[model samples]
Target: MRRKVRNYILIVISMVTGTVSFAQTEIENPFGLVYRDAITENLPGKVNIQPVTYTLNGIEIAANVYTPANYDPDKKFPAIVVAHPNGGVKEQVAGLYAQLLAEQGYISITADAAYQGASGGTPRNVDIPHNRIEDIHGMADFIIQYEGVDSERIGLLGICGGGGYSLKAAQSDKRFRAVATLSMFNSGVVRRNGFRNSQVNTIQERLKKASDARAQEAAGGEVIYAADNAIPTEEAELAKIPYDLYREGYIYYGNTHKHPNSTFRYTMSSLLYLMTFDASTNMNLINQPLLMMAGSKADTYYMTDEAYRKVTNAKDKELFLIESATHIQTYYVPEYVSQAMEKLNVFFGKYINSEA
Candidate 1:
C-alpha cells in the first residue's frame, strides 16, 4: 500500500512538470512597428508627408516621407531614404536624421524592419539576411514612385546595423547614388565574433548554445529572447572592452536613454543565422560612392574597417574616425550628430551635384 501511494504521488508530479515545460506564453508585438514623430518637439510647420504603406517580398512594410515644412509641389527636390539601427524605430535617431535633411530642402523617409517595432512578420526580429537586404530595395522602390523628385539623386544613410544593410543593398541595387553609415555595426561579424571580435575564441561554445536553443525551441519550450549579456566584472584588467561596454554603458543607456521602452531584447538563437552572414562576399563589386564612419573609440571600428577594405569598385570611398566618441554617443548627441550630418551633406552633395 505504501509503495502504491508513493508511485501515485510521483505520477502527479511528473504530469505537472511536463505541462509546465510545454506551456506556451503568448508574446504580443506592442510597438506595432510603425514609428511617427515630429522633427521638433515644438513640431515643424506645414510638412505634408504622405504616410504610405508598401509590401516587400509579400511582407507589409510601413514608412513616412518627410518634406520641408514649406514644401512646394511644383518644385522638384532630391531625396534620401534612411535605415535605422537594429531594434530601433523611425521615431529614434534615424527619423531625426531624415527629418533634419528634409528640413534642409530635401525629401526623406524612414522605415521599420519586419516583425520589430511596427513592421510585419511572424517570428519577430529573426534577422534573415535576405529580408534585411530586400528591405532597402523595397525602400528604393517607394522613393522612385514619389512625384516631383529627381529619381537619380536619391541617397541612403544607415545607422548601426542599418548601415551594414545599406551597404549590402548598394552592392547590387543601383538606386542609391551615395551611401553613408553613422557608427555602423556589421551585424554578421558582431553576431559571430562579438562587437570587436571578442567572441572569436568562443565560436564553438556559442555554436553549442545556439544548437541547444534550437532543440529547446523545436521541443515544447517557449521561444526565448536573450541579448548578449556580457558584463565586465572586477576583473576588467583581463576583460575585453566590448564586454565592459555592455557591462557598464549599454546597461545605463539601454535602461534609461529612450525611456519607457528602454529595456528591449532579441532572440539568442539569431546567432545561427548571423554567424553565417558575410556582407563583404560581393562587397567589392559595388561601383558607387561610400562613406564609412565610426567612433575612434567605438568597439565596432573593426566592422567598418573590414567593410572599407573589401570594396574595390567604389568610385570614391572614405572612412572617418570621430575622436573620443563611443558607439552609442552618435545616436542623439548634438556634437556627434552635427558632425555626422555635415559629412552626410557633403557626401551626398558631391555625388548628386556631379549630375548637374
Candidate 2:
C-alpha cells in the first residue's frame, strides 16, 4: 500500500507540472477560477467580482472581493472575510463561498495568503501559523475599509486550514462579530503529531529535520520542502491512503480543481514554528459568536470537534455536520456546498446582518 501510494504521488508530480504549463490557456474562466459557475465577467446589477491587491505587513496580498446584486457603495453592507485552506488560493473554495455569500447580500473578500498563491513573499510556500492567522486579520483590515462595507458588521469564514487560523485570529481580533469554519483542519496539531497521530514516534525526528532545514536556509543553501512529491496515478492506489482527507484532497487539489498556484508543499523550515503552535490553544479568547461545520464522515472531523469543544466562552457556538460528505467534498461538491451555505447564511445573518 505504501509503495503504491508513493508511485501514485510520483504520477501526480508529473501531471501537476504539465497542468501548470498549460493552465493559463486551458482554463475556461478568464480569471483562472476552476469552481462551478465562476464569475466570467464583471456584469452590472449582479453579483460582481473585483480583483484587488493590498500590502499586508510588507507583503502584497492578491484578493478578490464579491459584491451583491445592484450593490451601492453609498449604502452600508455587512462583510465577510473568507480565508482559503492551506495550499488553496482565492480562486478556489474560498472564492466560491465568497461569491455565494455575496449572492446572499453580503460583501465578501477572499485573499491569497502571503508566501502562498499569488501573494508576494520571499521563499514561497512558507506555512507558519502566525503568518496565516495574520492573513485572516489582514483580510478583515482590507474588507472593513471597502466601499459599502459596514465595519461593525464584519464576519469571518475560514475553510479547512484557513478555518483553523480563523479560530486563532478571532481569538483576540474583536473586529469580527461572527466567526465560522468549514472542514476545519488544525494544521499545527497535524504537523506536530501527524494526521491522526500517525507519526507520534517520529515527532522529535521530524523536529530535528525541521531545525536542519532552518539551519540550511540560514546558510543560504537549497530550500527544502515537505509534501512536494507526486501522488497516486490510479484509483486503487488513491484508495490505499489511510485517511479520507488525503485521498479526496488529491483529487480535489490535484485534478478536478487543480490551480497553478495550489500546491501541497510547504517550506520544511516552516515546521519549526508549525510544530510548536496549537490552534485549539487559547480557545477561550474567541468571545464572538462561533459556528463550525464539517462532514460527518470526514477523517479530519476530529480536529473540528476537539476545537469546538474548547470554545467554552464563545457565544451561541454551534457544531454542524454535513452528513455523508467528506472533508474535500465540502469544498466543491454542489450538494455539500449548498448545505454549508444554507447554514452559513443563517448563522452570519443572525450575528452580522443588520436585518436580523
Best by TM-score: 2
| 47-66 per-residue lDDT for model 1 (tens digits) | 54556788887788878788
lDDT of each: 0.68, 0.88
lDDT of 1 at 62: 73
> Can you write out model 2's per-residue Cα lDDT over 40-151, one digit (the tens) per residue?
7877788988999999999999999999996999999999999999999999999999999999999999999999999999898999999999999999899989999999
Worst 10 residues of 2 by lDDT: 1-10
- What is the RMSD, in Å, between candidate 1 and the native fold over all Cα? 14.0
Model 1 steric clash pairs = 32-118, 33-117, 33-118, 33-119, 34-118
What's model 2's overall lDDT?
Answer: 0.88
Q: How many angstroms is residue 334 displaced in model 2 relative to the true structure, after the best TM-score fit?
A: 1.0
The weakest ten consecutive residues by lDDT in model 1 span 4-13
